[model samples]
Target: MKQIQTDFINKLGIGAFAYISISEFCGLFEYVFENILIIIKTEPKIIIWLPGIMSLILFTVIVIWGIKKFNKPIEIDTRKVLNSLIYLYFGILIAQYLFIYFGTDFLTEKYSAEFDFYNKANKGSLMLRGYLANIPILQFVVFGIILLKNRKTVANNV
Candidate 1:
């Protein structure tokens, strides 16, 4: 039983770390792609959308897995974890909106005549990217807190 619990915790830790790292990488890739679009004067809608969607999917999978694998029915604080997940989702939505609002410039500058659209779109996209980049770090902190609190409880029980 003890070994099983330890294994579960370790797996959760690894999964959480991987999710955060992947999210960061996706953000970096998005940033790079945005710059490339600007430099090459190419409108890459597919490239821009892919990373965002992939990150969202990855995040969902990890969160669900963590809940199933790490959560203890008797002692785990499900409310806290759920709340954090909700907040994270909200952040993602806000980031997406900002990205779309600001990112239109890449499309407009490259393919349209609206400079104002470009300015608004690029600014929004940059802001959204920054905001989205922070989410993985926030999630890491939340998971760390959960682990620490759980450990404290276990220690108290022992």
Candidate 2:
């Protein structure tokens, strides 16, 4: 029973790790592009490369940490981790859509005139944002494939 609980918790940890890794990968690019001028002005050419370098470091750290945590008493099962990751990915999207729906409704009621006008004009963009926010999940699909392919080596190393 305790082992089952531990494995459940570990799967959740792996899901969280995957989510954070995706976020970091997306954020690193976003930050670098957004601050390209500031980086160039304040630092050298090498500094521009720092974001990529830092992202690599962060990716390595997260992978290592995930492997260590997942390789616990029962051994690391890639399938379970993958399932957890998929569940979490969809769970977040569902929750986000619910929030957007309810929030939009509440605000529309509160400020019917103002919100109605803006909402009508930006309806497409608002829907786009809702979908785009979860686009990071695409990267996680690649990550999942990598994990599945490397399961043998990962299990042995564990």
Candidate 3:
């Protein structure tokens, strides 16, 4: 049982690292896409779509891997991970929305001649803003269900 608990913790750590790393990469991609739009004459939609799609795929793979690795019959405390995930998603939603609402005007006013680029960047930002806004609420619902299952396991163990 001790060994199982240790293994579970290790797996959860790896899964958490993977999840956070992927999110950081996505954030970097957002910044890069915005800057690149300033100098390049590429299609903003494709630029945004490419990174978004790749990140989604990476996130999906990490989730599946985590599920397989962390599968244990024994009960584990999952509230920390669940709450952290919920809060992280919520923070991202708020940041993205704020950026969309305020960052566009700021960028355009400050950049002047680069207004065109700012506009393009704003469009890409808006797309992601919309996407992230829904993620936290949906995740909260899903995690809430999983928490119920976890509670049952904990009760059985007790």
Candidate 4:
């Protein structure tokens, strides 16, 4: 686990992984905030985007704090391993979407009630949703493969 973390810091040449973390944080944060606004009537639909802006500010502070406090290099260990946190992140994301689809009354709400999932009218909107849903999973898979490759080569060689 620590080996995976360290390889990320070294390969990125200064914690570029933090940006990915921030992006995932923002994505999930925005989704949750939007769902909340859906449940509680808000004056303007623009309220949904407020979470993204605030989260970006908060994430900026975290990255700055990390830079100032925990900039130590990660020691690469030989045992190839996986980070469970990555799986948990994606699991939470899938669960969140499932909750929105079934647990929440979002579909019945007037804002989204009009859209017909089976009809061809909302293809653009549906396509956008599909893209958004797939992006994180695809990113995680790609990075996981890269990390695994790096770990095997580095750990075995040393």
Global lDDT of each model? Answer: 0.53, 0.55, 0.56, 0.51
| lDDT, residue 125, model 4 | 56
Q: Which digits, one per residue and each the tens of the lDDT, describe model 1 over residues 10-99?
A: 546554554554455446545545554545544444334545555555555555565556555455443454446556655655665566
Return whichever of 1 and 3 wins on TM-score: 3
How do the predictions measure up, each by TM-score?
0.33, 0.35, 0.41, 0.45
Task: Give one digit per residue, the lDDT tens place, for model 2 in 51-148.
Answer: 44454445555665666675555655755776767676666556556655775466557656654454354444544455544444544554676578
How much lDDT does candidate 3 score?
0.56
In model 4, which runs have C-alpha deviations exceeding 4 angstroms?
A: 1-18, 45-48, 73-85, 103-158
What tens digits encode model 3's per-residue C-alpha lDDT throughout 67-129?
445554655556565566657666776676677678766766666666575465566377566
Which is the leading candidate under TM-score?
A: 4
| Candidate 4, 1-158: lDDT as tens digits | 98677676554533344445556665667667755554455433244345555555555555556444543445533122223334545665676678678755655555453323222333445444544455555445644554565564445543
Please report how far candidate 4 places residue 158 from its true position, in Å.
18
1 against 2, candidate with superior lDDT: 2
Model 3, residue 117: what's the lDDT? 55
Candidate 1 residues lying further than 4 Å off, grouped into runs, are 43-158
